[model samples]
Target: MTMDGALARIIRSAADRAAAAEPEVCDLCAAPVAEEHPHLYDTGAAEVRCVCRPCSVLFAEDGAGEGRHLLVPRRRLRLPPVDTAVLGVPVGLVFFVPRSDGTVTAQGPSPAGAMRWEVDASAWQRLTATFPQLASMAPEVEALLVNTARGPRAHWIVPIDDCFRMVALVRREWRGLSGGGRVWPAVERFFAELTERP
Candidate 1:
């Protein structure tokens, strides 16, 4: 066969292999799903979809789906907290976001907007290394939340959506490093919240 024909055959074969790999039921509709299917995130309705390409592309345009729907980013960012040798954050737990504007924004989130702060590379390194997953965090959607309250506690693998909750809890309830009584309760509550999620 000619080169163009060979390439077309190869593409078709790949598509066939993918089709052979799907589960029987559609994850969303429970209608029978073929192995070859597209995945979509409904930004307007906040839904995940296992759809045919036509349905997946329906919402592909900018500001589609009433502007509420956002595709669930398929890519995962691995961001670990970097070390902070300078201006050690008074509290151990802090969330750091490296913004698109080339600014490293740090905060713990409070009732107010993110109680903004910044840290140098050393501190960032210390925190990120402990939580390697933070290194690949998606901008605006996630952050590296680090806890060094009493010499570095275990890092929590949390969703970007949940970082604000951590900040609000820390700001409102934290009294001291032991997080005082108020802080511990909030931490427990946050922990419980994580456990309940799938």
Candidate 2:
């Protein structure tokens, strides 16, 4: 079967199982999955799917599935200095990812939910020039997550799933206008863990 076809089947199977409230399984093989497992982003669906290590390895090449499915890379880097003020996000944290339509999307966690806005193309180009690493981001699958909420502002190139997960975290923990008392600490711990990962 074509790779995309196989991936679609796996995603469908996993979704069916999830609907039944069963344990999470590999989207490709239906094997039981660990609490923490590799994921791929479906560009068409704008969703992340859990897959077995074997399946993940299949798509690990620099470009896989011809843009249908993108294996989320584990590489994380500390971004070079760049101005966040230009993005105009009210929140201290925001993530930028490229869309299939050639536009850049800027999103961040908010008390209501994930907030999104279209980033100007010229501005995006400037960012890529300033931080050359931005040029390597896998379109539609990887994101540049920036956290300026606390001391030592940080930037990371993370999977799109990770950015959405952080959005969920903020939505769940946010309180009042300032994001409750626990939100910042939780965010710190999350980044700390990421930094510790090998």
Give the number of the best model, judged by lDDT: 2
Quote the positional error of residue 16 for candidate 1 in Å: 56
Worst 10-residue lDDT window, candidate 2: 189-198
> Over the stretch 88-165, how does candidate 1's per-residue lDDT look in tens digits?
566555666654444466676444435667766565555556655655664443455566654334344444445655
The lDDT for every candidate, in the order shown, is 0.55, 0.81
**Model 1, residue 74: displacement in angstroms?**
9.7
- lDDT of candidate 2 over 1-198, digit per residue (tens): 999999999999989978998977887888988887899888778778899888898888866778788888766777665686776657678899987677888997888877889988888888788878888887788788888878567888887878878888888888888877989988887777665132
- Model 2's C-alpha root-mean-square deviation from the true structure amounts to 7.1
TM-score for all models, in order of appearance: 0.45, 0.79
How far residue 132's Cα lies from its native spot in candidate 1, in Å, is 5.8
How high a TM-score does candidate 1 get? 0.45
